[model samples]
Target: MTTDRTNWAGSFSYDARRVHAPRSEDELREIVAASTRVRALGSRHSFSQVANTDGDLVSLADLPRTVSVDAAGSTVTVAAGMRYGEVCRELHEHGFAMHNLGSLPHISMAGAVATATHGSGDGNASLASAVSALEMVTADGELVTVDRDADAERFGGMVVALGALGIVVRMTLDVVPTFEVRQDVYEGLALDTFEKNADEIFAGAYSVSLFTDFVAPTMTAWLKSRVDDVDPAGPDPDWMGARRAASAHHPVPGMSAESCTGQLGVPGPWYDRLPHFRLDFTPSNGAELQSEYLVPRAAAADALRALHGIGEHIAPVLQICELRTVAADEQWLSPAYRQDVVAFHFTWVRDAAAVMPVLKLMEQQLAPYYARPHWGKLFTHEPGHLRSLFPRLSDFRALRHELDPRGTFGNAFVDQHIG
Candidate 1:
């Protein structure tokens, strides 16, 4: 009984013969143990085929949505299927919050961590870096719990394993006391100004995002600053000649800003301001394709310059491009592993045929910079090329082999890119 299922962007339909949503952990373990091949499906936010399997696709959506905060330990254990939005609110109510959040709050916690999904912050690590522990149902139906403190050796590899090891049941993430954030959008920042003072511009706020079409003379800068971190008497609207937007503005040129988070430097909770989009509204351009390349922060200027040189070719298929910074982390497969990075993200018009050529060109231009593609986004990198990009690829493959000897979690995507 094949069911027609596609990801959030209505791209890459699943190849699984059946989809299951077990009501309990026992049922989930039984399903996993019985299947010859299996993959876990989250909120279907990924753009790639990483979650597709031929035999069965299991969704944790039906499992109990648990969110327990351990104040003493400064951590929160959330059900794998729970959305960040749901958990963040609960955490805030309990006087706690996750360190950061990706743009979309509706994405599943486990899926986000598994892909090393992240937000923009020079000081903030990928979402996976906050995982203190995680519980997974392995291929043989055994429940395994690994914590960073107890199993540091293997835990690093498991955080961003690309769903090849097992189905993540729950994750215990590090949390901090609730904090307030003020968001402001600066428009008309010239390309030269951005390139010249990139460091100061990014460090201007706790989390900063620059949105552009590559061909544009000026880009919009979305700056999210911690309220307490800023001095109240300091001069405001000092963004290197960029004018502050009087009203909220969407990243996409013509799209309505109604779905975006509050701006104009109004202080709000971390959950509300950290992510650009509001949880109640659709995130980004609903009809879009995304690709991101993470490069060493040192090569950021050269990478941006290279893109600027080919802006004409990119502007045709591009909806928008975002420049963000992420701190280094120890997650084995994380793009930001061991080095602070500048992420060049593209939100393209949803046309694979038209986007492929542009992606190839971008990849070629960025090859010298050693760019690593986002695990869940579209990319043209081959398995061999990817192996060269990630130093721990062999180790991750070994760990996968150890945990799933029969290859129960193996899928076409994993075989092609990970194996």
Candidate 2:
């Protein structure tokens, strides 16, 4: 057994080889072309072994950090390896920002987009939805470009390709002018709040996040909105409907789930409204396991109800259950593929032995909805079930062959899904 160790899934984990940080796209091309097997490493935020490889591991850390600003069209072309927070800060400087962000900012843009990472909004789509175009290095070391109108099928598959087709080098994203946001936290609101006004509440802002322990009588809603109509004059208490301090302090038992302390308390920079970008606050060095499933938007209420039934059991080891939304898109591998989706994310202390059964239980509970799992996250479904989850799976397979006919990009994870 190899003893070489490095960080993976938020902890120092064992791997066979030392990770390689390639300084340029040319270097990346050379490495992939020469290596018998390879996997592109992102910020290592993913909870699965999706990026794991026994052979060469390529890090895009040396990749260029460039965010091109286009004031006229309001778009930014960013390096695929750019951290989410870095993108926000850079975009903010250019007087622009993205529509929403996942809960933490430490993840890489390509990684998040590849997994269809998202925040809440009935009208908005997943992060991949922001891509106007992107560039990737295919299996044969050939660089290719894809966009909505050009090579739509390849673009759709690569949008959330889970790093199976190729290594994304950069992406052009549509942006909007910088705007401030008011994060109104409503704690202990009736569960009925969601059941009754889900639509209106979702429409109330550009994005919305609901955090629930399942046992609590009320949920916490963080309503994020554009600065356009924000009423700063209202009774804006620092903590509106705040939850108990103990919960925040000890949310996750041992893992650093990353609190919004630097983030949650204020209506600071509107441009950094995403949950995942705040870096200084995340928990330090414990392992974590995650399972996220997407249900139809209309079934969100029902999903919550089912979760409530097992709230207590899940809460002990559960770090958090986050509710987000995504508009349907054509991406074949996207969790939100062809469906207005409601995503429920569950974070558990890294105990695969114990967590597996609970995740299976969740699958059974959510079985009726044709739920699709995230590409770079954990799941138990077989290849057939995975194929059934995506409407464009066949098309994605076709593109996979066209791009990587020799299956040079194939790994255990990639092979299982698109083989």
TM-score for all predictions? 0.97, 0.89
The TM-score between candidate 2 and the true structure equals 0.89
Whose TM-score is greatest here? 1
User: How many steric overlaps are in each model, in order?
Assistant: 0, 12
Give me the candidate number with maximum lDDT: 1
Model 1 lDDT, residue 106, Cα: 87
CA error at residue 331 for candidate 1, angstroms? 0.6
Candidate 1, superposed: residue stretches over 4 Å from native:
1-4, 233-235, 282-285
Candidate-wise lDDT, in order: 0.89, 0.72
TM-score (C-alpha) between model 1 and the true structure: 0.97
> Can you write out model 1's per-residue Cα lDDT over 202-258, one digit (the tens) per residue?
887899999999777988999898999987753376568888888888889888889
Q: How far is each candidate from the true structure, as Cα RMSD in Å?
A: 1.7, 3.6
Candidate 1 displacement at residue 302 in angstroms:
0.5
| lDDT tens digits, residue span 37-144, model 2 | 677777777766677666677778787788888889888999999888888887888888787777777788998888888877877788888988888887667788
